[model samples]
Target: MPLAHPFDDDKLKEECGIFGAVGVADAANFVALGLHALQHRGQEAGGIVVHDPVHGFNSARRMGYVRDNFTSHEVMQTLPGNVGIGHVRYSTAGNKGQTAIRDVQPFFGEFSMGGAAIAHNGNITNADALRRELIERGSIFQSSSDSECIIHLMARSMGRTIPDRMEEALRKVEGAFSVVAMTRTKLIGVRDPLGVRPLVLGKFGDGYMLASETCALDIVGAEFIREVEPGEMVVISAKSGVQSHFPFRRRQSRFCIFEHVYFSRPDSILGGRSVYETRENIGRELAKESPVEADLVCPVPDSGTPAAIGFSLQSGIPYAMGIIRNQYMGRTFIEPSEQIRNMGVRLKLNVNRALIRNKRIILVDDSVVRGTTSRKIKDMLLDAGAAEVHFRIASPPTAWPCFYGVDTPQREKLLAATMTEDEMRDHLGVDSLKFISLDGLYRAVGEAEGRDPKAPKYCDACFSGEYPVAPTDMIEKGFQLKAAE
Candidate 1:
């Protein structure tokens, strides 16, 4: 299978997204709608599991987009129930490029208390060690996914109920996670103690829902309730309504700050802040940090539009759509020859030559990972007759790989890991390139005095390299951390 969309291969890949609901009739239908809204988070595979009084537990998983697989009447009809949970996956853990149907989630397992299905949205950093231990103790794994470890862990638990078993199962696992699980009578949601991933609670008609973002909740007409707190677990049923608990040890919440910059839907609300507004704030901060003179301020495309607007507003320059994206372009199934492959970003994006010709352009983008796409985009603009091109990035340089669910290449592959900012600009052949500082990024995300050196409010490990949790699996594999100054 093709690994990732050619245009997207240069960026950090989102891990997964999950949605669950209880006490609603035909819950699978709502789940499909929610997953459709969250399709951007993961496009490789999708699955849904539902529990009915008559049918017990039923599931349908497929290796494709939610719209292609879950929207069909034939697939939805098979998963008949009033309670359901769904997951869309991009495979951060096991079988990365070739995602098997077995690796698709909402993994189901039979237990003494009954059966339960779980959809996890973050990477379990300790999964390798746990998998080795579980296999030694006689646990049979059905899939290559690290998420399957949770099911095996639950089966071995001596707890009395499914929730208790799940709590027991998660205590031994480490790293970032936002999980949505289902038992016969309950819909459950839990976030890791640091809250590295996003999960929200919403109220629907007489029922409740949990999702990776508020945008999913809006897709099904669910009222926004609140974010599931860091380290908090909420169990919902028709009888009990919603019961909350603290299942993990208390620690300072370290929600991933990159969610504000890129991962989340622009319309979604996260951590009581508008994601779109925060992106705009990052642009304003970028302008303050690096002032430049240019004839036109242009965004690279859809992801850069909001920040470009903010940059234009702050600099009093006119914002223009210098680059246009082909919204209809989908993945190509057949392998292309060298000529077609060389087309690269041209297949997905085109320059608005009429407006940008002979103009000094300021290009606003979210972040630069490997600089491959940046070089291509700059070349495209220059070929379109732009006199000068400058890049204004919305986030700091990503110098470290994220172990908390986001799919990043090795440290050696990251451009920032090896090059200085000026060197990166020269390598990309741009007139100038500047990124927002870590302090500016924190300020844009509502940390007024900027990031605290002692106790940061959010996880900026990819930029600062101050990992909140040591990556146990990587350490075992001989990965090194940043040296102390």
Candidate 2:
């Protein structure tokens, strides 16, 4: 099992990132760099598959970080092709804590049409049902990963071409998916109908690339073309350039709101808005909604920095580096003893004693999941002689587990699920704890009128408890939805 990071365990996790390149020399190298840029999306494992006209399809899937596993010239040499796709993974569906090498993706399948490799970035809501049906119909499963279902479905499709078969297969499956796939000569990218997850198209000279975020494209010096539209699929090849298709029935696009809050790199763009600017706006909105009397507005390190700056600007409070993060610390840092293991948050973060002492500090954070981190940070602040520690979360209370690609604890484990706002503040031992309201968040994300009850602009299921796409597998297992308000 991959060791879970001490701090990462307290927040939601994105499943994976997908990247593909077509018409570039040794495209696998480009894919590797793209995955490295997207390493924040997933760090447990990564895989790359490329097709050379002479060598056919070759793949290297390893269990670790992209730089650790895929950077070697030996591994890069093993995959040679002008077209390829890759994935960096953190298990959300199958074998969650025990991810196997077989579970690592850019999963490959041999077909009558030839061979295709696929890397997926979202959850399949009906995967269990689909897997069972496929198995009963004589499909032998390889990995426990829900993503393998796509390959099996493609095998059963009667369509002539690989893309045709993929289209046929995806129509039968339900839930969020942003898939990057490749055949011998072509690279493909598709986003789910609701645009629940992001996939963008980029151009690099004569070649083209597809990635989970625009930040990846920036790494390889690719020019950002545009986002792959909801329900749209693009097939790219050196010969044909790019072909677009919309196979799924149209619906109001519900892009994941959390991407702006935490998942994506702050440098990336989403919904035509800068993620960093949006987070800053979230802080501004939070300040307006919940004014606080504090001497310093301090961010909970990197993720909260932009929001903290906005909060400081809005409230006329001085922004300070109240807490410092050890940038050298990797997630895989070993704890040699029980004492060291118990010093979890301290391993990653430490309070700036001199700067924050005797100050009324307002700490801005992205979100609170279990409240474990919040409680510990508060204790640390008090111990460092801070007069007050107030938590101002940029996102709303996370009361519901996401059934999309995000890995979240059950409802019972979520702090916001069981406690009210005041209760949470009391439990965390903070002077005050406040989260931006759902409407405030919506407004920050460029929704002028806030979220509409009948029609929301983004998928905020984690905060709102109103899932746009029904979690079929969970519902069948007796998971209940929020009752009418």
Candidate 3:
């Protein structure tokens, strides 16, 4: 069967997911389960590398879902190790084909010190420059991915141990990175200085785990330990247990706000708050900021469901399944071609003609990226005889593209990037449209006082464009940064 695209063809795509475990029997099995929980982060490819005392290191990397590739006993048997790391990848930098397998990670590198396999989440803003420098220094790159730079940097580092070399390597790196690496007997996890991405430490029996989200930990029956702090490197070994090192310079935390908005699983906990509750709060905030009188408050489905519920309660509008989504249809946004993506909305979502006909409907959705899906939904609702369609977005206008880990389109391609609220409503042919204000978004995420102009609570770069980390390579390559509106 041909692979289906992601659920929504218009939202930002998460780059990758990382999971690792040490001191466990069938460590690869546990890692596989953890990756399954994080499948939403990336769906293009999956890989696992395990380190067995007798077998040294064994690996399997395939371009498909974890269940299809790693669930088989045949594939799991090949990776027999007590310590391992795994990755689920989506192509952001590399080519998308069979040749891209070279970039499928849990990327293994053999240094003079030891052999290590690394899985990374988030983009390296300065990767191009680093890659160029590494190439000049006689480092032959095997893949087009920026993540390969980490391995090369570690290889050339003067530090003696793998952890030390990793720290040294990361010091030269600039951008958001949550990395899980396994070296012989040790499993390592590291978060960038700004904490742009998330990595958590979890405990399962006598073993330990490092994963991109708490949801991954839960899949392996691991107890929630604590998050790996920003600028911290956690080295887990049979002998040492868990040891932490602060390798990077100190910086304030700027966790990706989109995690709470759309990326993370609703059941997961982030920053001491439940993602589901946060999204509901976002709906409540939206209702307060942008209220519309309508017969029914409807969600775009799945992503919009929680907020629609909250909006219903807050606005006193009845919630109904005005639009239904096909659970079997994967994310349509991940489809390669524009033509497929253009047709994806119809394939994934259908209007409940009976419920919406001749009624004023409030359409609640998470975020509008290109506006193609929203426009199509509006047309569909009107065709079904809906008298009025009012769009209520749970998040602020997505005016800028995300460069960290999210696969967002360029600014020019974003709907909010070029149009005002009135223009967007007119373009979508909706009766009314309103987005949650930036302050309202902050409020919903538990920031009661709203965003601080000086030091924001979370990374809202996609909405605000005030990137905490400079896009160093882009700047060096003559890409001027646009000022945040």
Candidate 4:
């Protein structure tokens, strides 16, 4: 995860998800782009590893944007055959690594039992304790990522097959997780018992695919099949076809709502909810929840557009594109260091003075991670002649850092955790700021019922602090050792 690059945390990060497949012809490239579609979920590093059932596993992991990381021809050349998985990462200081590529996704392991590459999405709250338990048994780790702890658990499990060991290992690990692994001959996918992250299955001609979001399927031209049911274990191979293991509580399917609010692409469908529609619903509810007096409802660009449209429809406020986002700019501006990230923000967003001049502008955005970009965007609006700049976030303040696969910040890095809402408004220099109430957000996303089979109640612990799984203290120190480059 880019060796836990030092920089200010921005809007609550989607922190990159992953995608994979088995039996597809163009496996490597398809998975690469699938990861790219998930770039919004993460931006630090990206990689893919392909396994030939007849041969061995070949991995190409690099630390950079998808484009940069996969640029090396070797990444493609090394992936010899079909059946593969890919990952994009945004691990913080604690998850970043030094020379050990073990921290990289598709973490490979060979411990007398067998060898496999694991691709993970979501954090494991009990990671620290799990690591300590394994360490006490003289388990030596090649990486510090809490995700790698799973491999060790598998090694110790008394199961005969990889799937058995995997399922057994998973039973012992606690916290939110959705994972995909590739063995020498098979593909394995599993979601946490509580299902706090999103994972789905896709079909490409005769081949089967799985990814964090459906956008990956469209990019790869894979046929939309269905979502991997929460609390399900799917093992796919030519011999076994696709087998399922529903080892968890059926009521435990709690898909992360923030994925719809900010992380996924608008076109993507996360757990049957369209990202665009869900976000719009949030905006619509915002208007109903807290109507505001404003001249124009201006979105912060990209993510806020759909929500702004909903705001306009509900409140009769004119929605205008008051901010222009420079989509052409590479996520990695690449000058020298973190200070340059702020410079990238200027290049990325420009305020429209004509629209905001002397107007009471309400700026809508998805979520605020560190309040860095919000502060800058607000200053941009005020400087562009905004009279009363009001900031409205479509989602609630990210009060908690995700420990699972999502690239969550530390307790110290979360703006909401560190500062009060009133202090945040002052910090960002916005005349007003308000987050969608947790209840309002739930209703907007059709989660208030918590009865839908596909859309069961989820863990909004990041918001409400009611953890679904009994978490161990490992996650508190998961980042203490850091991930790899």
TM-score to true structure, per model: 0.98, 0.99, 0.96, 0.89
Candidate 2 lDDT at 323 equals 94
- Give the per-residue lDDT of model 3 (tens digit) for 242-344: 9987977788899999899889999988988999999999999999888878999999988898999999999999999999887876633343676765564
Error of 3 at 175 (Å): 0.7
Candidate 2 residue pairs in clash (backbone atoms < 3 Å) = none
Q: How many clashes in candidate 4?
A: 22
Q: What stretches of model 3 exceed 4 Å from their correct place?
A: 1-8, 93-99, 331-344
lDDT string for model 1 (293-318, tens) is 99999998888888999999999989
lDDT of 1: 0.92
After superposition, which runs of candidate 2 have C-alpha atoms over 4 Å from their true positions?
Answer: 93-96
Q: Which scores higher on lDDT, 2 or 3?
A: 2
Ten-residue region with minimum lDDT total, candidate 1: 328-337
Task: List, in order, the clash count of every candidate structure.
Answer: 0, 0, 8, 22
For candidate 2, give the lDDT of residue 464: 91
Ranking under lDDT, best-scoring first?
A: 2, 1, 3, 4
